[model samples]
Target chain A: MQITRQEIAGMDKRFRANFINSLSGFKSANLIGTVDMQGISNLCIVSSVFHVGANPPLLGMIMRPHTVARDTLQNIKDTEEFTINHVNSSMVRQAHQTSARYPSDVSEFDAVGLSQYKSTLLNAPYVEESKVRIGMQLRSIQEIVLNKTELVIGEIIEVQMDNKYVLEDGFIELEPMNGVVVSGVDAYHSTQIIDRLSYAKPDASASSIRGHAK
Target chain B: MQITRQEIAGMDKRFRANFINSLSGFKSANLIGTVDMQGISNLCIVSSVFHVGANPPLLGMIMRPHTVARDTLQNIKDTEEFTINHVNSSMVRQAHQTSARYPSDVSEFDAVGLSQYKSTLLNAPYVEESKVRIGMQLRSIQEIVLNKTELVIGEIIEVQMDNKYVLEDGFIELEPMNGVVVSGVDAYHSTQIIDRLSYAKPDASASSIRGHAK
Candidate 1:
């Protein structure tokens, strides 16, 4: 089916949101953990996380317009710190529950039955149940003026994970980590390694990297 | 194992790149097709695509710092048009091959053996093998000062896909579409739908939406 801009613009709001959201394909699913000035912790599932750079160790995620109360965005602005915990297969249900619209005073950590882990370097709490957790310090926040959405960029300050998951080449084995991806608003997915090819070269045929395949 | 920022900064460059890149989890893999001023078609595999907004139908993707010549970014800037085609399982190898550094005059479509599908709605060419293809008009380009990376935002102008792949709720069935996701630089993944739950609510347990589970 072909959907032109006219057809897409004419779509029902809810239908359009879902259709447009899933059009980008599967997204990184993570529980963003944050804390307010009052030391209240907040956790929410966000799938828009993407790599911005690797040298300064930066990561970025999009936050919807602040027309409504957004505790995560507010807390990140207040404390300048947060944790991104990858949503794994074991706790996806609890992770998704964190998306519920709760009061500002209510901590999703306690509300969703997920334990929080704290460290001296950051004010935001981490999801103790998450296998791959990253502690980040707010680097900069850019308001995408086109739409009122905010692009929150953070520098990774701390990373906690099982050493066994890290390969000699430094690639973390996600399948063993049990990390999952999300589509639309509610669908969860598990990934199977489809083969990692060697670095592409203009004159060479792509070949599988030895021992990189599961 | 816990890695601190100090340790990350001190790691070998290659190891650090791999580690930091993989830390963000899986990303949406797509072939961004663009046509230069001379009408030459170009395709490159990019994993940074993410949803920005739905109302105006926007999408954003990061282009590495243009310290080197980048044909796709230059084409989008010159022509103000491009197409994002989701990479599928059947063409994963061919798609990955498009990442190889090619000269400005060389089109990955011809070099990588993928056919281009052109439409009148947009000047950019689309990948004929892709199931979900999006035609976009360049909206804005913002450079991240923290890193020299460029964020290219585009408005969805056209969408072409199979009718059966879209559900009544507007979510595209990715598994049925054979859409694939990428982790780190070279790893490709095929996703299996675990389940699609009902909308999260403060006091309710998430229940699977009927017939949405795999």
Candidate 2:
């Protein structure tokens, strides 16, 4: 369809939100993380999380513009540390509860019935019930003015995972965790391993299509 | 299980690889519009892009990092204009081939098999095939310390997307596009629609667990 610039701009504004909604619709789990600042704790749900770099071990998450002060952003800013916990089917409901914006002084950990555990190297606490947790240090923060959003980049400092999800080579198979994927907004979807393509760089040999279709 | 700082760091490094690998798995489609001080033209392709916004939209992507000497980045520096297109299933193959690294003067539309269109306000071009795109003006360029990485961030000026993908009240419905999800290093996963969640604001009304099964 021929979409104009105005149409596109209108759609761009809702893309992430709709994607998140589509994602949440599946009743799939959302990525849940906990942040603590000066003893104030908060739980935040994010779906715009993605890896930014590998060499420096970085991950980036785009946060919606905060209409009010947010504990997660405040915590990260204050402590320069945070924990990322992978949400699975088991923690979907509790994770949803954590999305509630409680007072900065209140702990979402208590509201969600999630146990907070001290991170290995960071001052923040992670969700004990989460199947996968990674301690990260703030590396950068940039504002997306077009959307008035914030992108948080964190360098992975540590990782905690249950062996059941780890492969022999240490690859974390998120499948069993009932790993949920987010769409635009408010949507939660489950991930199914459809096809595992061979890793091929642009300089490498093109993938052999024969016997490779899953 | 408890994880140590050193152990977490080790896992963090490896997980970083997997995370980036997963991102690489999904092909990114964007318009490489060029302006030779006067005219603007759009080119489309799927690149394994990365974000460098250590601060706020200080976004960056690893092109051939060498490709910068060519047209896109050159144009951005000369005119400080560019755009980002988020690819969906419809243009998967088209976006994939746009990464062929054509000569500075060669347009991917001619090199690859995709069509291009001009932008409205920006002098750059937009991929007719992409469903969503962000128009930006160049902010800065930084070369990675030891790697052939060129970090580029632009001020987002415009966002484009299809109207159907947009819902009333400005929510984007991304599922119909059959948005392709990425995993590993080259795997492209198709999405399935599920449920949508309400925005998880501190005071947003709590979602009902009526249909949810733990």
For each candidate in turn, the TM-score is 0.97, 0.71
Candidate 1 TM-score for chain A: 0.96
Local distance difference test, candidate 1? 0.89
Listed for each candidate, the true contacts retained, as a fraction, are: 0.81, 0.27
Pick the lDDT winner: 1
Output the lDDT of residue A32, model 1: 92
Q: Model 2 over residues A44-125: C-alpha lDDT tens digits?
A: 7665465555666666665655632266777787778877777766666667656666776778887667888875476788
Docking class of 2: acceptable
Worst 10 residues of 2 chain A by lDDT: A19-28
Candidate 2 stretches greater than 4 Å from native: A1-38, A62-69, A140-151, A162-176, A193-205, A208-214, B1-16, B19-72, B100-105, B119-123, B133-162, B200-205, B208-214
Q: What residue pairs are clashing in model 1?
A: none
C-alpha positional error of residue B81 in candidate 2 after TM-score superposition, expressed in Å: 3.0
Residue A214 miss distance in model 2 (angstroms): 14
